[model samples]
Target chain A: MRKYLLPFLFLFLFVFESIFVQYLPTEMFGSDRITVPRFLIISILFLTVFSSRKYGIIYGIIFGLLFDIVYTGVIGIYLFSFPIFAYLMSKLMRILQTNIVMVSLASLLLIVLLEIGVYEINVVINQTDLSFADFASLRLLPTVVLNSAFIIIASYPLKRHFEKFMASVSD
Target chain B: MPQFFLNKRLIILLVSIIVLVALIGFSLREREKVTWPEQFLKDMTGFVQNALSGPTNYIAGFIENVQDLQNTYSENQELKPRLDKLASLEAEVQRLKKDNAELRDIVGKEDALSQYEPIQATVIGRNPDRYHENLIINRGENDGIQADMAVITANGLIGKVKNAQSFTSTVQLLSSMDPTNRISAAIQAEDNKKVFGLIEGYDKDKKLLMMTKIPYDAEVKEGQNVISSGLGGVFPEGLIIGKVVEVENAEYGLTQTAYLETGADLYDINHVMVAKITSMSAEIQEELQSTLEEEEEEE
Candidate 1:
């Protein structure tokens, strides 16, 4: 029962987003930066922290695909990406345990790479033109800050929640 | 020796299986409708995100408020001299408003123009993976939103609705790199020249838009405007697409590529107009005209 509860938390969050939050555009202090569906990042982080690498891989794919359906982005953008991100985050978390700073940096790196990878795909697919100005400020820096901040705040809860859930599962 | 020979054959069989799998993957991609099941762990992602969103907003908002305060304080110090300039600017703005109203009155006669119907949506979800992936909108079938609906802000186009539910829909942004996003557009100022091109997104800081297939002879001076051609019926004509930023005459071909500086801040979208398309198709036109001509002849 508890096993279902942990993952259900994530499912509830996603469905809630589909129903309520998807409409509320992310307005930060009145500035609209490049706000993609942010829940993916938080979920990946949360699932990776709470569950094992295998579960992360499973949930990551599920989460990413749901995001693609929800957003209708490159239909497979998250579907293709989330499992990889989940698998990676899970592996990295296993070894890089106990340091918030390293975790923060990892989160920042993950955010930056996610943006960069998307841009790379866009260019390769000729979906849009490539501009240097956006590469610098609009696309990269803003998401980096946003993703990093999210990971920082959630890091504690993610760790605590996952730990409690894992312990409950074992018992 | 027989055992060694058998091991070699087994290794070769394994290699062949790997190669076959790879070849099938490559060939299958062109028609792959790969989708949702792969990424979505469960719907619960939203609840977790909802939990995380609070404090994240708080901290990010705090930083921005501080930044805005600094900017406002600095502006306050420079307010006196700018006050006179601002008065002149206000007068200029009023003059422009009158001119705009006059233009609007004239253009209002052209009822064929695309009418903007607006629906307000929250930016509840961002692209889960990448910054430019796409946006999920809460307004869906219940709001009368259908697939291919043009989503826009008070400023400009965001993208079109792809998949919709009773309560929500997914928007594929103009920034999405899908090749099918080719938009037919017209130059804002020239009015006579139309550019059939695709708006491809790029790796720029401000979500830059680039247009290809500007007639080699088109007068695409920098700062000239770009607007949709209303060709595909996805967007209305005359909505400000962007301003021409860079016009290129590369030696390889007799085509011009223009960079349009997009209008709306793609980062912050609130209320967007879903243009209800009301254009007559050529087939419909032909049928109606032929019937009218027959009626007149009988008379």
Candidate 2:
């Protein structure tokens, strides 16, 4: 039962991403910036840093596929990006010191990469016509701020949870 | 480091990238319906979304109610005068409806393009990614919803059903930048005339609907109402779409374009109605089908 906690947590975040994020008032941001919740991806990054990279990539693939099928009509965007980013993060973790600040910064970088990749694909497929400058200012900046804030607040708690869970599983 | 080209991980990455490209291309085609596996996954996610959103919406509604209380007095003061006018307006509408029905009876015509049945639905989830403005509703194929059905609110047209699963459906909002998302619309002109055009795209900067292909000589004013023309055969006629806010000529000077402010607020939506156009009669439908086939044969 305890071994299932991490997957259940990721499931909750996945569901909350589609269901509750829209309720946050756009008027608070004054309508210029669009703040997207990448909570699932952010937490998966933390899982890679604090727990096992293998488990993190596995969860990333599972939840990424779910995100693709449930939210977007396109399938391969998240399905490919999420696990790729997790693997990249795991490699970066080997070089950098493990701490809250580094984890948050690394998560922010991964998110920027993911957003730009998705945006470029959208441009090629003619799904959007937003200029590169406008995309950087309007969507990319605010999304980074929002996700970084989430990572800052959630870093310690998630770190502790994953450590405890890994202990119990290994036992 | 190991030889880069010979690494097993590199080979796996190359294979997956090829697979990803294939999947994206396959899904990008114009599909009539999703496969059963995709439908099953959508239903499963939609079920959980529905369950979770109910309580969240209740809590959000409570917060909104509290906020509304602060404006209640001023809102009531403004609405009091409108209340008196509403009664007379209601009477006028009733009289006009009766007259129109009598006229239709005299003409021996019972079927109208505006005839439709409304299916009420609750919004269960919205796509987190803001690029594609899509809403998942609690109603689906089980509720007689089909792809391309017009989804509207009491205010006016919002979007159309993109996909219908077993117990849930996805609605693509008008603001999405899909090139194929075109609607046949008409601008209400002077003396009860209508200037027909295609609502071809959306201007993201201005947050307005772009109506194009109007004749250069057509007179479209800033305040004119835009409604679906039903020429597209998907949306019902006379469904209010928006009000024109600006007009300009095309670059080639052969056609005009207008920007319209949508009647329904695309961002904040909770409940909607799917307009199911009622086919006239079996005999008429068969006759129409036969005529269409004959026209195709001539072509």
Candidate 3:
């Protein structure tokens, strides 16, 4: 039962982010489109922090492919970006003492990198028409704010879960 | 020492990049149908989306209903005059319909949209990518949904299906700025002149559809209603798209561009009706006219 918790949580986050976040009132955003939730990726980053970095890379690939197959028109954008960001975050964590503040800052920095990475790839393929300035002000800023709020709220509980999982694995 | 110089991690990185490029190249072909693996995953996720959306939507609806009750009295007062006007217009519309039918019979014309069949579906999910405008709905190929069928709510046209799986479909909203999704639209002038244009793309940030190719001399204005002209045979005739909110001169042409505010609330859609045209437009129109002429000759 314990073995299933992480994957189940990731799946639950995916479904909720896709379906429930849209229910948020547009008035809150002052526009129709809301920021895309990065909760699933954020949860994977948590795994990298507490349980194991390897698990983060593995889950990122599996779930990222599922996201690509289900939602995106193309197949490889999220598939590669997710695991790369996860690995990068875990590597950065090694230099700094891991705490809610440090992890939150690292996650924010990594997410920004991921956004820019996706945008550059999209531009190369001529899939996006948005200018960099507009993309930054409109999408990246709000997304970072929303995901930061999520990290602040979930950090402690997720940290505890990851530590437990790590301890069990060692035993 | 020489073997140790070649890192396993570097090789893995190189291999993943190649795999990534290959996957992108493969998926860029624009296939008519999703492959089996994609179909299977979409179906499974669709099931989960539907299962979870049901109870949550119910709870959300309940909250909205409670809020609506608070506004009911004022809303009723505001709607009373419109309700009276609507009743009178409904009767007038019925009379006009009968008159139009008689005129059509004499002229050997058929209903402009008789080829369409509409299927109702519930919206289950939105595109996880904020930049793209796609909605996932509960109906798919199993319910006879096909690519390019127009999806509309009670108010007006919202989008068309881009992909149809066995149990779910993806609707590319009119707000999608893809160059390939142009819709043939026309403005019904107050003087009864029909001016045509193409809804070419959308401005996502501004939440407006960009229509082009209107003749410069055409009498276009803000607040004019735009509807599908059905010139392309892809969209059926007279589907309400939106109302013109602005008109501007073309960047470098003899044409004009009109920006339309879509009537359908793209932010808060729940249910939609997908319209499938059963017959080819030109063939159906010709058949109807020929039969009507034959009957008249017999008379």
Candidate 4:
């Protein structure tokens, strides 16, 4: 049961992202800016940095597939993008310092990449007609700001938890 | 370059990219219904989502109730006059409904296009990705919901069921940018005249529905109520869609287009009713079937 905590955490974030985040009053933004909570991916990035990359990639693939199947019409967008970003983040972390600020910055970078990648794919598949300028202003900027705030609040606790879990698993 | 090709990680990356493209292409194709695997997954996720959102919805509703309390005095003052009118209007509607039914009985018309069974549903989850603009509802095929059934709130038409799983259905909002997302709508002109057109697309920036293909000379003015025409044979007739906001010439003056402001707030929706067209006579059903076949052949 204790071993399932990480996966449970991911699942909670996954469900919360789609369900509860919507209840956050959009009027708070005062403009029609799309703020998608990529908390699941942010936590997954934390797992990659603090725990094992192998487990992170596995969790990414599983949750990514779930996200695709449950939320979006098209499959493989999140399925492909999530694990790829997890892989890329792991590689980037190897070269950079593993401080909280550095990890948060890296997570934000991954979030931007994932957003742009998904946006480009949607454009290619003609799922959206939003121009790049509009996407940047309406979606990308707001999403980055929202997720960065999430990271700022969540990173310390998540990192400490993952480190403790990793130690226990190794032991 | 040679070493790059030799690397195992690069090979996995290239292979996965190919797989991704293939999966995307497969999912993008038009299908009559979602496959069983997709359906099963949706049901599983939807069950969890339903359970999770129930408490959250209650909390949100409580907050909304508190907000409503603050404006209760002003709202009551505004609605007291309307309450008297509503009583008379209800009586008039009942009288008219009886008269219309008697007339239809005399004419041997047992079925009407405006008939539908409303299936109550609660939104369990919305697509976090804003691009698709989809909602997952608690009701599904088990509740007699089918693809293309109009989903509406108390205000007006919101969208239609994109697909129905066993226990959950996906609603594609009218605001989604899909070329094939068209609805046959009619503008209620003065003197009970209706000018027909198709709601072709959504103007995202302006947040309005675009009703197009109106004849250039049609007298569609601003503020006219738009309702589903029932010519598409999917959505029931007289379901309020929106009110026209602006009109302009299109196709080099061959046709006109009108922008409509939807009554339903597409952003904040919790409950919806799937308008399941009910009790159509055999003749009308056959006519609809033949028209559908003819259109398919034309395509």
Candidate 5:
């Protein structure tokens, strides 16, 4: 049961991201629709940074596939993007320091990359029609800000869990 | 670690690419149907989502109510006059509806115009991806919801059912800028002659629905109500959509375009009604359109 904590946490974040995050009273933030916080993606990134890149990839594929099947019209986009981005972020973190601030900044940059990558892929597939300018101002900026705030808040706790998981694996 | 895992990363990359392509191909098939595995996942997650959303929504609503109280006094002052006017209007509208029904029966036409049955549904989830703007509602095929059924809130039309699973459905919002989800709409005229047009797209930056293809000579002005035209069998006639905020010439054509501040709360909708017209067949729709066109031509 203790071994299952990390996966259970990821699953809870996934459920929260899909259902409850939208209700956040962000009308005070702006006029446009508030991009709900991507807690699931952020947690996956934390897993990637603190644990093995391999764990990140495996879990990314599992949860990413679940996300695709549940929410999106297309299936492969999230499944492919999540793991690839997680792997890339883990590689970047190897060079950067692993403090909360550094991790938050890295997580922020990677999320921007991930959203833009997804947007570009969707544009190529003719699934989305948003222009790059609108995408940046409306979606990219808000998502970056909101998810960065989430990272700042959850960074310490998430890092602790990741270290515990890593310890358990080595043991 | 097995001896066969020498090129693990390379194999993983290859496997990911193959899986990605296969999933995309399968999803884009002719029917666009969900496989059993996907359906099972959706059902399970939908159940979980429903369970989680209930308490969160209640708490959120409570927080919102607390914040809204400050403004309620000012809003109440504004609504008092409107309430007095609305009571009179309500009685007059009810009388008119009965007379119209009697007239329809005398003309040997059934109540095709106002014969939609609405299924109430709770919105359980929304796509976190801001670009898609799809909503997941709890009522699905089990509640007689089908693809293309118009989903409306108390204020106005918001979206239409895009897909219907066994216990849940996905709604493609009116705010989405997708070209495929055009709504047939008309501006309300004093003389009751429809100024028909298509709500062709959306202005994402301004958060407005874009109405297009209006006749160059039609007198479509700001502050007029826009309603679904029932030109296509997709949405029923007389469903309130929005109010026109601007009128302009089309970018490259002879037609005009009107932008509407959609009446429904696209950002914060919790519940919706799916308009289901059971008797709306292609043949019936064609007949309805032909008669409507004949009436317009005579006028």
Candidate 6:
């Protein structure tokens, strides 16, 4: 029961933020469309801390594929970017096991880089005029701040659960 | 853990990626033609989406009906005494008439225009996320819509039919913020000189209808009319693009900013027109010439 609690709760919260929280106080922040939100990056980071390395990568890939299918995009964007994030987090695992701050910083760096890479490739190669204005300031800064905070605050309980899981499996 | 499961997952992933790539390449190859399987998928998706949207549509329709009934009920009560007078007013239809030939010509033009074959559709779904402006209409391959079919209305242009499945089609509206929406049109005036422009959507702040490449010498006024250039093979000449409300020249030179406003109210539109262009002779030649010039300039 406790093991499923974190994934379950985070899933609900992410969905709520994805669907609803982004629309509040419509007078100021409302717009026509949003690019892929950075919540996905934060989700991947949390899962890396709690789940197995292989499991984390698999989940990210599956999530990316789902994102591609549900949204009208180039179909392989999330598919490509997500696996890279998974691999990086897995590599980072050895160096930073107990530190929440390191995970937050790493995830934020990857997300910002990922946005620039995707936007540039689409604009240059495909000639898709996806606007990068929202991405640079209001969207990126707020997303990094909010997501890093969530990941840092949520890491302790997740770390404990993973330790217990490792113990049970080893025994 | 054994490696068998990992091997299986790898195989599945590789196969899926291959399939996705193949489909993309396939679509790119035949960008102009409508495939049968894609048509079927569109129809089936529309059927499912329409089934899902039935309840919401019913509620909205029901609310509208109640309001209409309330208005009619009061109007009927008030008009009871005037009904006898109105009946006499209608009798002049046969007696008091103008030039018969002129009236017939007036009626004949729109009658021919309205003779277009159309499949009625309901918008079953929109892009679930707030990121893209796309709508899925319930009419698809089964409804006779093919890829590139013009989706329009009695008044003006709405969009084009992109992917038509069996019973549903994904309509790419003219006002879509996507940069690909380069509508070919001309200014409707004495000159009717050739013109082209791009239409982009904004949910707020004067949903824009932006035109490009109009020469500075072109005598364009703020209230001057814009129409489909007919130079493009896709749209017929003189479909009302919009009334040009403003124009400005930039320091960059050569091209003036033609701030156009479209006639189509996408937010209120419930129906559209899709024209299947048959003869591509004159229009195609003109399109080819203009496009070549534009490409050369880019080069």
Best of the candidates, DockQ: 2
Model number 1 iRMSD: 7.5
**Which residue segments of model 2 deviate by more than 4 Å?**
A25-30, B1-5, B279-299
CAPRI accuracy category, model 3? medium
Against the true structure, whose TM-score is highest? Answer: 4
- Chain B TM-score of candidate 2 stands at 0.93
Ranking according to DockQ, highest score first: 2, 4, 3, 5, 1, 6
**Deviation in Å, model 6, residue B19 alpha carbon:** 11
TM-score of 1: 0.61
Candidate models: Cα lDDT each: 0.62, 0.89, 0.85, 0.90, 0.83, 0.59
Off by over 4 Å in 4: A25-30, B1-4, B295-299
For candidate 6, write residues A47-145 as lDDT tens digits: 676566765677677666544433343456566567767777778767775466676677777777766766664454443444577555534555556
Query: Model 1 over residues A1-171: C-alpha lDDT tens digits?
Result: 667777677776565443333333444345444444355566666566565666677777676656655543444555656666666666677778646666666656666666676677556545556575657565567656655666767677776777777788779
Q: How many collisions per candidate? A: 54, 0, 0, 0, 0, 16
Candidate number with the higher TM-score (2 or 5): 2
Which RMSD values do the candidates have, in order?
9.0, 2.1, 5.3, 1.5, 4.8, 9.1
lDDT of 6 by residue, B157-219 (tens): 777775666666777766555555666766654564555554443322355677777776777
Best by lDDT: 4
DockQ of each: 0.18, 0.72, 0.60, 0.70, 0.57, 0.09
TM-score of each: 0.61, 0.95, 0.91, 0.97, 0.88, 0.57
Chain B alone, TM-score, model 5 = 0.86
Instruction: Name model 1 segments beyond 4 Å from true.
Output: A1-5, A8-58, A72-152, B1-120, B190-207, B250-253, B281-299
TM-score of chain A of each: 0.78, 0.94, 0.92, 0.95, 0.91, 0.70
Per-residue lDDT tens digits for candidate 2, residues B1-299, read: 55988899989999999999898898888899988988999999888888888998898789989999999999999999999999999999999999999999999988787889999999988889878888899999999999999999998999999999999999999988788899999999999999999999899998899999999999989999999998777788999999999999998999999999999988778889999989455666677789889999999
State the TM-score for model 3.
0.91
- Candidate 4's error at B131, in angstroms? 0.7
What lDDT would candidate 3 get against the real structure? Answer: 0.85
Ranking by TM-score: 4, 2, 3, 5, 1, 6
The residue-by-residue lDDT of candidate 5 on B133-173, one tens digit each, is 78888988899988889999999999998888899998988
